[model samples]
Target chain A: MIGTAQKIAIEKTKTSKITSVDFDNLPFGSVFSDHMLVCDYRNGAWEAPKIMPYQPISLDPSAKIFHYGQSVFEGMKAYRDKDHNIWLFRPEDNYKRLNVSSKRMAMPELPKEYFMEGLKTLLQLDRDWIPQSEGSSLYVRPFIFASGRGFHASPADEYKFIIATAPSGAYFSSGKVKVLIEETYSRAANGGVGFAKAGGNYAGQFYPTQLAVEKGYQQVIWTDDNAHEYIEEAGAMNIFVRIKDTLVTGPVSDRILDGITRKSILEIAREEGIPAEVRKLKVNEVVEAAKNGTLKEMFGAGTAAVVSPIAAFGYRGSDYDLPQLEKSYASRFKKRITDIQYNRSEDSFGWRFKV
Target chain B: MIGTAQKIAIEKTKTSKITSVDFDNLPFGSVFSDHMLVCDYRNGAWEAPKIMPYQPISLDPSAKIFHYGQSVFEGMKAYRDKDHNIWLFRPEDNYKRLNVSSKRMAMPELPKEYFMEGLKTLLQLDRDWIPQSEGSSLYVRPFIFASGRGFHASPADEYKFIIATAPSGAYFSSGKVKVLIEETYSRAANGGVGFAKAGGNYAGQFYPTQLAVEKGYQQVIWTDDNAHEYIEEAGAMNIFVRIKDTLVTGPVSDRILDGITRKSILEIAREEGIPAEVRKLKVNEVVEAAKNGTLKEMFGAGTAAVVSPIAAFGYRGSDYDLPQLEKSYASRFKKRITDIQYNRSEDSFGWRFKV
Candidate 1:
């Protein structure tokens, strides 16, 4: 076991691309920082962590990752405060969840020292890359992939863990997104890897989401694979439904992601005396609520977008437009979360980690 | 659209590794041939196909394949006849299914000529890598992955398609395997990418299969995710159950792979006047048949293993041993398939393609 006090080897790049980037007009994940952290798991043990220049990786053509998709990832962000102090929202949670995903994929669990020390060193080295603009942060992506060379359909003996960060603007540049209630395609099954942030889960959604995009919806709200009756997730985020004044979101199970942002919102709702319910949100119930004019709001929660409000939703060839409010729960939760992330407010939940 | 007459660029290796390999003892999917096929899809079109020396591939760390698992693959084999002529069984079917998987993963479809011409050129260059021993052949793997650099959760704009071949022995070295009927973990779900040869689908099964291995079972007989009642697949292959005299197998659906070898067996059974039924085979039905001594055999069918017989199966803490017969359907189908594959018998189905 590696200790948290272990030093991470860092090799700085000769020149940085910070000057070339337009932080004001940044895209969601197109631009990356100068340095990245890479750790390899070989011979049944993880090697020393190293922070080096962000570059392309060379792998064998028959690597298991290319054929079997033995990979998992975590999405997080680093926010810059008014005084230029960097803070991460629930970094430990991300680390723990990453291992949870790794175990489910039959990959080796990464040591905390390697993940934490390496991430901090990489972020400190590339501190200038963190955008300080409003609603802007450095989007950090930590991923692990099978690096073993073989064409066999089995678990890999070698693996690679890498952390790449991108300085980006808002996830949804538009004010609010219009989503379609998916009835044909499903995101996850009852006993599948849907709960894990596995790579294949995202790949399986591209086609169905593209169809929804063609139908004028920005994203698709995925339902259960068994019967498509219960609502599950929205795009890649955990979804929430606001019926009247109570906040209703589905419980995390083998088929739903235990999202950090989603959990934070539930806690914040409790702290603010807002009624919140964590239960299975059925599609027909939401549709009935929408038809009766009781569905107040709906939004998605994840690391990329802390809170993305859904303006309207289409289901069964009919569109249901959500009512716009002056001071909605989405806006309220977004401000509370971002305030804590940016270090502009009190950290009552101890969710902010200073770097 | 590229035509069949298009010439493929070839770069042969000066030194071959054939001299170092011991053909008598070959492992599955570990030894690679001298050359491989490579093609790139960029700017909304596929580039010219090229055959190059087998080597490592360079990709960006943020490539969609690494994080989103946008990949699909096909498994095939090349056999050497008595006259040393290379033959491919149902190669066109594999090609069509590869595209079907691509479409489901939102990937660009490879032109038939690029696939066929490139594969033949590469195989011809490494003709010596095709093992002539009994139950041995050149296992060919053709796969495509997202090569575009991005961190967004969407379909990739660029992709790479490659074909790598390996000289290997039998997939199951042991004569018969003991399988565990899975009830907790599921391989695929309804309305999911279970039918497609998606990389993630294979990755998700590794952990559960590992558990079954610990329980003295070599592989798992996967059931439906909704309810672990109906049998779907055996390991990575299509499963067939013989109850009394009639051969029974599940019909292909969105949750079951349309295996080439599986379909071929059904056709062969029809030609041989063997009773075969294509329908859903429930676990209780099989268990009842096994208790009454009506279950004679169960086998797996796929490209890697033409037919792998199962000796016993465990479900709900009880083990059921299958009766061994002097003239079993498993042995008969195995001989019939290999005879056709090695050109020892007549090719009545026109399934053989000459290179």
Candidate 2:
């Protein structure tokens, strides 16, 4: 086993591109930092982690990633406090979830030390890229793919682990998004790889989400595959529905992602004396709640958005508008989570990790 | 629209690597031919196709294919007859199916001219690499992936269409394969991408298939996700079960792949006066058939193997061995298909395409 204290090889770029970037006009994930971390797994062992200049990678045409999609990834963010101290929101959870995804995809599990040390070193080198403005941070993407040269429909023998960070603005810039409740298209199935942040899971959602977009919705609320009656996820995030005074979200199963932001929100809600239920939420229940004027709020929670509010929803050829509230649960949860992430709140839960 | 007579730029290798390759001991998909075909889709149009030396491709770390799994592929083969004439079986079907998969994955479809002209030119350039042995031929892989740069969960703006060929031995070398009937895992879900040749569809099966391998089975017969009672597919191929006299196979739906070799087998069975039925096959019916000694044969059909006979199958902690037959449908169909493919028999269905 590789030790956590293993040294990481660093190669600094001769010149940085920090001066040419427009921090205020940055897109979600377009602007990458100067340095990245790369590690190769070959001959049944991961090589030493290397932090080098961010550039294109060369891979054979027959690489398993392109042919079989044996790839997994994790999304995270590094926040900059007023005192210039960098913080990460529950990064260990992301690490564990990445391995869970890797195991499900039949890829090799990455060591904790390689992920942590490499990410920290790369972040420290590109500290200037982290946006200090409100709702802006460095979106970190750590991914692993099958770099082996073969076309067989089997697990790959070689892999590549990479960490790339991008400075980004808010995922949903200004308004709450409108989502279509998808009944015809499904995101994941039971006993499948839906819980894992596998590449195929995201790719499979593009077509259905595009149909929703064409119908004037910004995203889709994916339901269960077997029945398409129970709510599962909202686009790439875990969905929470506020009915009456209780917050209800689907329980994490083999078909739903175990989102970190989602769990944190639940913990914060309970701490604040709010009722949060993790159970199977049916779409009909939400539709009835909307019809009876009991649906107060609905939102999506993930690392990218922290919390994205849903302004309206369309279900079964009928549009339902949500009533705006002065003190909505969506805003409260977003504030509570971002406060912990940016070091503005108490450290009672020990959720913040200083780098 | 690109016409069928579009020009394809050709760049030949300065030297050949054929002399170094040991053709007798060839692996499945490890070795590649000297030339390959590459075409790019950008700005809402596919560019002209190009035939170049088989080599590695460079892409940014944030390429959508690495993170989103927006990739699809098709498998084919090139056969060399005794007179050195090259032939392809049902090439148009492969091309049409590639686009069908591309549409389902939200990828840009390749022009017919690009796929046909590019493949033909590459095969002509690497004709010497096609092994002429009894079970040896050039395996062709036509794949497309999202090459655009982004990390968002949406369809990419650019894509790459590539064709790579490898000379190899038979997929199933000599003996029949043992399979496990999966009751806990699934290959696809209803209203999912199971019908398409999407990359994620294959990757999701690796872990479950690995479990079957650990239990002494070579592959798995994946059942439906909802009930795990209906037989869907066997490993990466479409499965067929023979009970007494009638050959029964599952029909293609949103949760099952439309295999090329599978449909051809059905057609050949009908033409040969063999009873064939395409419908939903129940696992319990097969178990009953096995118990009564009426289960005669089971086989997997796909482009890679053409036909692979199953020797035994295990279900719910019970192993069942099939009776050895003097003349099995697996052998008969494989011979008939190979005869049509190699131009040794009459092309009644006009399935052979000469390059």
Candidate 3:
């Protein structure tokens, strides 16, 4: 059990213990690490944050966060090297992206120093949890919520910023995944909070994703809400498609998340002398390309699953099975990206952050 | 500080010894009452809820609620009658509205017992904060959050249900407020989380609301995202327009919140035999109605202020002032609503819930 210490005060607790989280095989979000970092905003200033043992918090049911959904979040990972030194892959991007999310959600912008220092301080203490096995890392989640009384439709006077870590393996146990192109539901809309990593945006997709799972698909690839023509993203990850020799993906807009891995993969593709293009990839064009055997490969890119190759696509109850190729682009992209992440190759893009 | 001992064991804390919050000088959510109610969604079942003294909670900052906005909340108030008895007006409506919000946002649906039992328990302990002052009541905020670990784009396995109270004064101290009609910015989209009380939906409006405030308006009335032509809700409140004595409000959709106060106002309008139309209210049509002297009164309705009459509107740098009338329709509606709320008048529609 963690000590009952307040993060803002830096006041030490009578007892500080190394708590243990039951790390038996888990099904995501079930287990947690020992210590968590928290910072509170009140009186027009952000207080000093602290790391204490993980425990349940007491909140007035009336706090603005739970009801009004004034919350935003970021996703990044801490990789464990062969030498037992902890490394973070592209953490600055996560910090910058978090602020971008904060701006879109109208939450206060958390300083990059605060994000870096908080995660560093917190992860340094929980470094044992970063698995060294391939496709394993310490997933770090940083989020902020409005914490105040009553339910007026305005900003909360108080905010709580907390960080938690989870030991996670690769997103998929299988080599490839199947996606269902969503026709009815959308992850986000134009001029909406789609690009932001706000909690509500994720919650909005659960039912549709569940429907996809029920229909024997791994995830649903969302499209633009206004027209449902332009491909947006797949579940939480950004997607890439290879038509003939050229790679095509959707452009980043208010409706699409600007994925860090998506950006990295694009950079890698160019460095490898592969044709990578970011533009409006219409659904019909991709479907036609797949039918004509021009679409050689399709995959999702995100921090969790560096490159998840899509083996098939289900649309309007019609299944389109992708042909297996001796040399696939997804395998190449995944290997190149993961190598840089684990520091197995030269760090040309300066993506690795050593802890 | 409230004892963490009572927080864990479901034992009621002794709040009688705690210093009470001054109800008279309450500045919105700054002050809280002595007790709070909470329930947990664990082991796939909601446990029996409890009410204890209000206190701080410990949580991993990376919990899904903070980052992804996997949070939903509702705002309602417990009214004090002239006879010193406490009453709740159609809390079932708020519960239903909260569920609607939950389904849309992909959070777990709170049980009716957690919604009702939690509120009753908290209000019973903190009834002292239910101000007897006119237009004042103990504001109740019931919310649910994603308490699970990690930042993956999936539904949370664990959740918390809480109810907190704050004593608030009248929504507006002086006369009717002026609002700016936002032609560009949007609150929610057809496939967005706007209809739900999701936090990100409100966060997305903060910047636009600030712009409206800078334009010398209290709130920015939203329009549809695609065309910015159809009128939606106000900043944190559902809006109403009176056209030639007919109370008009927008039809609730993916773009608008299903407010408890909005539903009640509709009931009151019907009971009084006043013509009330619920449909798509276009901004241009509203402007024409105001120019033709048919727009009688514009008001914003929610649990906090109940109903605030809007005196004028600013659109594209043009100002339109609603005529001032004696025994204004807004005053009549607010009085009738408050009368039934405070038990001063008969609740002909059986809207009042005795606690």
Candidate 4:
């Protein structure tokens, strides 16, 4: 409650575009909610947050964000429970992570009250845009970028923090996807800002991911920049491997993103009496396990997809198909999280927050 | 020549702001010329170029460039001759490199005719902004970025290409600077977009470079991401070392930017009968040379500074001072290039083009 005393300015749109949008055929981030939250930083302090109609922003051509990529963002979702109440899943975690990313990018940290209160207000105003369909929710995007017109290759003096919402269906239409183990390109290195949700971290992976896509894979399993032996993470997601009876994933480091979905799944797996391990998973070990039929399943964890099962993986010019299970850890964790998210089960963890 | 027949639409400003600009105390990129070149891309082709008044551009909050860093840019300069005629040095190279960067970032490639003709027309319209003082020129920045509001972690369908000019003095006011050898962080990796002038590449270095600056260093000498044994480039420039009359530099690779200034210096060094070698220079070899007094001089080569001599360098928590020479190769090369750039010497290589 940092800026609780500061009143937020509100401006409603003259007309609503919600009727034109087909909720049944909603895209992930194409259609936006009616309102957006915005706050500006200048002169050593943040301005009062405002909620206005979702619209385009006017920026100078020389804004540092466009030239230096000095921007950070967070991705979360608001689920519409069966009772018609809107809920945010661990939004405080997203607020904290956005500051972590902003610090790494040399941008200023936003106030907790500004971020939290603004988002709650925005979501309340656009409650009707929240999708009640199963596995669909209103995707929340909170981003901050350098907005001043200076080109000094340093942190900008001015910044803009914004929260925009979009009604999104399932991230991936396919139930399963194939991935490529990347060796030539590295996603991040030691002491780099890889752990931060910076825009460049995502941009740097597009070319390599495209190459993998051209080779019949939907995503790339990145490796350490120093050595290609150890598995890092998947494109925009954390990876998990199930070998026989144990679930293994790469431990979060300075070079690995600490995904919220990944953490939630690991917690649910442990609660369900499933053994889980967090250690460096070598590529060679995974390849060997795939060849010997010990690697039972692989999946990607992120906010968008929740849980994306990997059908096959390609390594060294060969593809290895993963075996499917009738009752697997991924499905179990996915169901548990979604059950809590949709308010179908008791809230044991106190993870959901009402807007 | 490609678009010589196509007319570029020009719009003049109602009133000039030239009188308000302080050319004598100009910051690097804070001030801009009156006019700018702009073009759009959609449906598989580029629109006709237009030169309009420099102003703010309206963009959607979810534009790909703001979230995914899908952008590329080029830096060059326009010089004013003594006869008041404007000239551009090797703009076609920048035009071609812009496309190279665009391809790597998955953005649409800009046409050569659009780039060249638009720049020529804009410069012609804003000719009064070019500074004629020594060590000062109009900095030309040509850039292309994703303009559509899509958050699919993919390339955008709409694109904007723009060229803007700013009157700038020297990038680094100090003639000599100290650099730190970075071993913990990496700038680029194998099969990465390091060679491309992508915005993410620059953003990734700010944190590490800030650490170096706090340690009393002006820049950082980056190393290979894989081994950290071979030298790559400086923060934004290419590193060149003179060892007992033989010049040595790291060869261009996927992890190093093909700097325009680096190439020009290499050509000038060879043409002047100074033997130059391009190979991987090991850190151990540089330390050994420094200890044995074989390293005569070290300098950074780039378009901004032209040639910035290195005063010292720190490695492994120890600083090594480079002995100042009476007549260093850095000074000699700097004089030759500046003389040609200022139109005081003959253009033997046809690098200069009149506007």
Per-model TM-score of chain B: 0.99, 0.98, 0.93, 0.98
The per-residue C-alpha lDDT of model 1 at residue B141 equals: 97
For residues B143-192, could you state the per-residue lDDT of candidate 2 as single tens digits?
A: 99999998777889999999999998878656778999998877787888
lDDT of 2 by residue, A83-160 (tens): 999999899999999999999999999999988888888888899999999989999999999999987788999999
**Arranged by lDDT, best first:** 1, 2, 4, 3
Per-candidate DockQ values are 0.89, 0.86, 0.49, 0.65
lDDT of 1 by residue, A241-341 (tens): 89999999999999899999999999999999999999988999999999999999999999997899999999999999999989899999999999999
Worst 10 residues of 1 chain A by lDDT: A1-10
Shift in Å, residue B273, candidate 4: 1.7
Q: What is the docking quality class of candidate 3? A: acceptable
Note the residue pairs that clash in candidate 4.
none
lDDT of model 2 at residue A89? 88
Model 2 bad stretches (over 4 Å): A1-6, B1-6
Candidate 3 segments whose C-alpha is farther than 4 A from its true place: A1-36, A49-61, A118-127, A148-150, B1-12, B17-19, B60-62
Q: What is the interface RMSD of each candidate, in Å?
A: 0.6, 0.7, 2.6, 1.5
Model 3: per-residue Cα lDDT over B193-230, one tens digit each = 67777766776787778778888888889888888888
Listed per model in order, the count of residue pairs whose N, CA or C atoms clash below 3 Å is: 0, 0, 23, 0
Residue B261, candidate 1: alpha-carbon lDDT:
90
lDDT of 4 by residue, B12-37 (tens): 89888899998888778779989888
- The TM-score obtained by chain A of candidate 2 when compared with the true chain A: 0.98
Task: List candidate 4 segments past 4 Å from native.
Answer: none
